[model samples]
Target: MGAVSKEPTRFTVEANASGAARYALGDRADFADVERGLIARFDEIKNERGETVLDASTFSFIRQGEDAPAGVDASLWRQSQLVIQLGLYKVVDHLFQVRGNGANLTIVDAPEGLVVIDCMEGVEMAAQAMRLFREHVNDKPVVAVIYTHTHFDHYGGVKAVVDEADVESGEVALVGPGTVESFNKYALGENVIVGNAMSRRASYTFEALIPHGVSGAVTQGIGPGGGSHFTTTYIAPNDSITATGETRTFGGWEFEFLYAPDTEAPEEMHIWIPAINAVTCAENANHTMHNIQTLRGARTRDARNFARYLDETLVRWGDRVEVHFGPHTWPVWGNANVVAFLESQRDLYKYMHDQTLRLANQGYHPIEIAEMVQLPDAIGKKWFNRYYHGSLHHNVRAVFAKELGTWDGDPASIWPLPPAENARRYVSLLGRDAILAEGTRAISEGDYRWAVQILHHLVFADPADAQAKELQADAYEQLGYQQEAPQWRGIFLTAAQELREGAATEGGLNTASSETILAMPMDQLFDFAAIHVVGERAADVDLRIGIVVNDTDERWTAWVRDGVMNARPQESQNVQATITGPKQAVVAVLLDPSRAGDLVSSGVLTIDGDESVLASYGSVLEDFDPHFNLVTP
Candidate 1:
């Protein structure tokens, strides 16, 4: 009773029947030239029973070193191979996506045990989701864990599925929403300051450290949440659901919740499954068109409240869904293709909020309606491609802040000045050979986002032009090879491989630990000091200072007005230190200004009102130096 058609051959995966690992991978190896270019780009948009179907056996390949040993260094480090073919879904049986970008992980077997939802990214994918649930559902013992969102590939593999004697000896239950102030700033706000500034374009946009073959790096065929960390930390949620259509029914799985604050995530939830009609759309109905600001920056979503939570989650579970599942990819069965894939991902977030307000009501701002908004033909011939994780110039500035708000209405574009002294007086009035010949004629008219804004002002007006920094690193590696947004193809191919290689000198930025900065929370350490708090050196010091911890009794009061670096709860006092143990013993005495009094003499710190006023307020705190440099020198 199932001979349906049009792509989607019922459920993918079926390839690599070893037979001598297919004659020990021959066809000019980089693993047979990336599986013969993903079988000739899925035979140019497949559909004849989608040819040999999915073709991704089990999955996990690494070669820029996984401590070289598999099959006697399989061709001894073939230029650091990496393919991570994601797919782990048992959702409803010891439930697992257990490592995402191949989504939907359920794990609810009951009879008083197991509860997980999303958790992908190692402990070998939570030991391959406990060996595919003790060989097909029920080998019991897990009890609880439900971090539906606050990404890092959905709860960085909770110590590879429960430990520290099962969450500090309570035996599971963990859970979500405001999860301990979202896991205390979730690994220093996105892998220590926006994934070392969007992982220098996420290692050439998930080529996992560069592979320009077939237009450079590609695993973001969407599905497999990535932020890299395995034992990162996330067991908070000793149960909390917060409003919007919440329901429970634990173990035996009834779920049905919705809350999902600030859309696609910022404290999220979505589950629904009145007995496996399945919904779970947690990265808010994925299939592409996510992210609003994210260029390693945050706090800016609401594309009209993400199209009114998918037009009220398709009027509350559009006829009890049929199958949706996600955390990254895979899973979307029938029921009219899950209500036309949640009404085309809810009209692709209402056509990026009605064509960025029909070209900002024709006045066009927000980077000229994000350089004239596109994506029609019903969300651009859906393959759910944005290559992986939201793009379209951050959803036309999330529809010009949903019709102009966070002040892009302009006062000379709201007091702008310091994008490196407005890129050194616009390269001293377009000089450096007329902004490197209008950034090499806007990268030979492919216009790569205006040739990455005229090669970021000729690499900030000549940071010693090595031929205008190697022709703006070959126009940011051909706009990170026509990006389909894996963070805008790793931020224009990690700013053209750091203007042809530069940053990352010295150290400190593979990321996480002082137990991930004593696990973040005084509201994500004031949202990671509102992203590296300098706010004009905390508004050139009006500074308040009072703080206390004495090991988590917690006290806060750090204000620094007008320029903005606020912190609350002092009531009234100049009090500067009632200090304590961990929060990296006060970020190792406030993020290093030559390790204050040698970290209060290495006893992790115990301060006073004036250890030179916590060393003149931790020298205006802001050490985000994740191996610096976004573009060139």
Candidate 2:
């Protein structure tokens, strides 16, 4: 036969059922908490053009009280049922939240007006969420906006709720963790260097192209499936919480911030509202086990730091925190329950960190360590600590990588052949017929992981081999069906889709915004330009350029030599060219040198000396192809 069928195989069905049995699926307390305090529900949320931004009805296929279909993990299906509860909920006497929009938009009643925490992922979603809040809850003016972290979902919708003029005029305070420079550096510059590669990978991680149904995406672990497509906007923060125990009174509410860096994000903080006995741990603590290293890719989070922050939160405010909410998932009520929740989450990460290091000390490789470590039942059995977002398998590997780097101490394995060449050699050595037979047999034996690995070489060796592609896709689908973590599920399923169909034609999540780019500091902007320079193209190019920003009164010297670009503050003697202009015009010409003539002619830029230097440098800059291939060579 060509391959196993597209439908969930008997092996997949049994695997999913067995996984579901491990959880207390019949316990309906989580369901009660999800539906509690619902003030009103939106029929659906849409953008200006009437395109749907979010529609809970789309997930109606997931029956509330029924067992999960074979295509989805049973535990995940139950979580999705709770996630699809879309509405404005009253968290307490003064706090309200808008859910089912990827990130939670919380509104807190302050003395002057409303204090908003987080603004969803984009303009439309935040706008719709704010509209619902105004319609159902209090319609007070928003006096302050607080961003819990640097992630887009936490603060990208800034413009939807607050005006830039107001922030500039000091009419509203925009508060964030760390200094303004640090926030801007991470928020705007973190991904600009390797954005294209990360974006393409994110398509698989978030199931960006997967349809919402029983057989497709169900949830993104923290919330419903399908990433947003609205306009993502940003505004720089006016006030910074630089240290833990930093206090800022926004509209009469005493907000205590815990500056948590390098946890879920590079710059993040948790909010403790003392007057209300409520705390929002930002994205640090959530309903599910959060990513120690996100599937899409980022610097590995310090699991020790993650556990430390949770423990600190518990020690500082465990007795006083009556209710706990976050940017994602439902809140935990009751001080005792909240404390217990924090302890479990804290222990979960601590165990992962300690155990992984223990095994590493015993001379185990990351792969071997991943297979060895297991969560103890005391914390592992809790619903909050379940592997809905992050799993023990990948997380243990992340901890290993964090401590011991990528190398496994084998010099022979260190310098390996490129993927395509290696795959070709493997196929040639094994023989195509033997590899295919083994793959099929592995699939028949419910060894989808092994099947994918063996068949992957065949597909990579010969991209047009339809038989290999189909067999690999079948294996991936079975693996996808059995994943409890949605990120793993998304990756496996999207891989299967790519194998069966082809690489995605369009790009994935793009975080670069005009506001963000413009806000980039001069040094960072030059750093961004350096990464864009192609080494081979710039090898023969030699130029020293001087730059002056009139508005910012900044001076810099940049030069290209020996296939690399370098820059420093202050002007250099004997520079070939000096370009003087406002920061915007200078940035535009630097990004796209073809616009130099128009800008100079329009009096936006003043070019002195050899004008051709700009052209010479620009020629070496390369624009990234967003839709790069992933599964295939």
Candidate 3:
């Protein structure tokens, strides 16, 4: 569609994509026959302002009818075509899924009313998904909403399908495992500290910054990429599913939930509908490999536990599972196919973990292990097992980082110089011309990895170097064009764009969204506030402030010591100042110091001792610029 790259495409990439397509042809049945029964396709979803939330037409540039473009991988293009097929598809009897509407929203027909699982992302998309669901299927009020996990994609659009009034009046039951706590912690907590970094990195991870085309963003590897631009909202769950083998019949449908926490998400679970002989694997077993530690930073997932959970799914519900679906991809039919899918997924994680550990035991570092570990035929050869979302390189290192820390136990590697310093030193030692000469040679020889590494040092050493930056961007473009994983391509391309043009003017989640701020517990709020306290600024200042919220009787003591801020539930014994206020007032002042005037004026705030102690403590708190430079700084 765009000016395609002239660089030679690798034979391995073509072979890999061809192999994947052939495997799919052999192993998969007719997916289109299942799609034909869809009631309707609502591709155009718009917001109140008439802005497209999930534009199905954005991906129309890459037509399914056309052959794979020169720069794009054929298998990935095929997956892209599958992901972009926006419609309501019938999974089985009484079960329907509105796929390609951002996230897959599955509608289950119950006797009393309709039950919906996984509410896309925003009100716009969710409402459209619900509308699509109602059009093909029978129109019934949503009696219950089931969230398989704590992720926002599974539950954020709750307000769209059912009213809060219904949920409040007990007409609708909001169900999930660890939904509220997990949502608050991951979605809201400490977002102010790391939100921008995560958002920027996620933009790359999901190809949000790139346009959708053959040479640009194709698919997210799990789904299509047009749903990135949307408002994020969360609706807390009322009914919690705590443990595995938990069975609950809502409106006459018996549903069993299996808790699989710390697998794909921090708090996640899989669902089994015994009545229909169907199972929802949540985000656990998707079309693509799920991330352990996402490119957007998160706590490392336990690979061992992840593998075990998949095995547990097989042992618990494999025999009865005739149809299996997830929040991302198409449904898998037939018991044998479902078993193979689950088993391959199970072994995929197990092999990645075991092999990484085996290599780590032999004193191989993360980089070495990542390069060395390879999936066997049973796991890697299958089309479903292809690394679209997750790859061997990153996942292998993730496993290593989990079992062995980043240290690598090498004394020489312990204290490496920072990037800028090291880059400058390298440039000075080797000479800029010499470095550029070698990088230029690598680029010509199609050794892009080496070219990127060398050119990166030259650019960082002198950000004003036009030739170095240009060459690096070129190298990144070529690598991006060749990458099978969409996220890796997105990251490389975004980096190149930033180098060529400039950093993005706007992007990132609102850390202080009204709902997110209100739902936060006082303790979690305090923990987030602690992160804002600049360690360098508080290094020499020993300030202790005891907070007493008269409204809630919640007491907290926050102190700065050794350049770090620490907070505990109990009040300090020896406090410099005791600040007493209502819970709302205290929270307001804690979040925004400017609100202190309003609280003080209303007689809602009072200081017992030296107010300077509180003032000094507040002064150390730094506001991070969310728009900080990424590639350069």
**lDDT winner:** 2
- Give stretches of model 3 more than 4 Å off: 1-36, 165-171, 179-187, 190-193, 508-514, 540-563, 568-588, 598-618
Q: Which RMSD does model 2 reach against the true structure?
A: 2.3
Q: Please provide, for model 3 over 1-633, each residue's C-alpha lDDT reduced to its tens digit, 9 standing for 90 to 100.
A: 134323434643454456446555433343463364576776677787877777778778768556566667666776676777777878888888887654788899888788899887777778878887776678887889988876656666778888887877877888877756664576556343465566667777777766777667788877775674455566667687878998888779999988888888777789999989999888788777777777766677888887898899899988889989888878888899999998988888999999989888888888988888878877887667786778779988898888778787789889999999999999999999999999999987778899999988898898888888888887887777777788888888777777776677765343344555555677777776777888888889997878998877889987788788777889777988888987777877776766676678789898778777766777888776655666674
For model 1, where is the 10-residue window of minimal lDDT? 1-10
Q: Which whole-number lDDT from 0 to 100 does residue 598 have in model 1?
A: 66
- Report clash pairs, candidate 2: none
Give each model a TM-score: 0.32, 0.96, 0.90
Give the range of the ten consecutive residues with the poorest summed lDDT in model 2: 1-10
Write one digit per residue (lDDT tens) for candidate 1, span 1-633: 011101111111011122123222342323332232121111111112433212332123442434322211122122223234333344333334433333434565655667677666434455555665666545777777777767655665576677756666755667676545554354346665555565444444443444323333334445322323334444555666777677776665667777767766667777775666677668777656677665445556776666677667778987777666666544566578778877887777777777888878777777777767777766655545232566776678766875577677667868888676787788887677787788778766656567677767766766777777766666665545444355555555555555665654642224344445456566555555556656676676665655565566677776656666667755346654455545656655545535657666877766665556655556676665545665653
For TM-score, candidate 1 versus 3, the one ahead is 3
Q: Rate the local accuracy (lDDT) of all candidates.
A: 0.56, 0.85, 0.76
